[model samples]
Target: MNLSFTTKRLNVIEIDASSSMVEHHQLTIALPTILTPAVVANLPGYFQGIDSIAAAEKWLANMLNECRLLMLQSQQQEVVGLLFIYTEKHDAHIGYLLAEEYWGQGLAFELLQGFINLVGASSQWHKLIAGVDESNTPSIKLLKKLAFDERASKENGMLFFQLDLRKYPLEEGTI
Candidate 1:
């Protein structure tokens, strides 16, 4: 997989144990901002007590071992959010979160759209899946806007969504 890519307003880079300390430090500091109470409430069992560099590093290590983790950086080079993808067969399950301060700015749409364009054009993944908490209305709307069809909801209050890449229509001026 490509470790680094760019969108119109952000730089997306894969981050793992081998990533620079500076990048990890930036992410550690940005954790609180990105995973605010509202965000945390939406994401269950994903992040907890990750307030320090040590905790963040450990968390990253554990996560990278199972998923492909990407750091979302703004044009100014500040850590703004993260995107993680877990692949199974021909499907890629993705999750993303942006700093509270960056909310309502269309960044999420841009980020996801750019990602779809990239993966749709270059990867063999047959589909993309996303599971959002039932209470995360904004994310539900965002997924729908991206043409992801709603699948069955899990008993754990998570609503599943999917986008079949073969049937995804390319946007004008996009790959």
Candidate 2:
């Protein structure tokens, strides 16, 4: 299936093993910028001990093997972020990270809203799930703004949220 999409100011492209070497190399260099300590602190068990290029490559390979990874590139042709999705049954669990420099802007909201517009009507998934650390108030606010409902909270301070696509189908220009 075609997995690449574009937003008003960004191009979202799927990155698999089949992706070009240039894309992979760009992602490798962009990883350090995207997954800064401030961003990684909220995501547990991600990019752990990735202090070198070799480690990052291994981690990227493992991630590409397990998840449908999407690279977020800016209009200027810069890799600025990543979106990771894992599917189970008819539900899709998603996680995303943006470069620290781009945090204050509305790119996160646009990225997610665009993604919802892209897949909300598809029959492959009935729900979208996202787990956020309880302390990440900004992310929580963003998801709530997107109409995601809080489903549960774990003892580890992680909040579980889900958006039922059938009930809240996001279409382009409607959001």
- Please list the Cα RMSD from the true structure of every candidate, rounded to 1 decimal place: 2.1, 1.7
Clashes of each: 0, 0
Error of 2 at 64 (Å): 0.7
lDDT of 1 by residue, 19-107 (tens): 88888778777776677676677675658667676767677778889899899999999988999899999999999998888888988
Q: What is the lDDT of candidate 2?
A: 0.86
| Cα lDDT tens digits for candidate 2, 75-157 | 99999899999999999999998888998799999999889888887658899999998998899999998989999567588
Task: Please give the TM-score that candidate 2 achieves against the real structure.
Answer: 0.93
Q: Which whole-number lDDT from 0 to 100 does residue 42 have in model 1?
A: 62
- For residue 93, model 1's alpha carbon misses the true position, in angstroms, by 0.5
Which pairs of residues have clashing backbones in candidate 1?
Answer: none
For each candidate in the order shown, give its overall lDDT on alpha carbons. Answer: 0.84, 0.86
Candidate 1 lDDT score relative to the true structure: 0.84
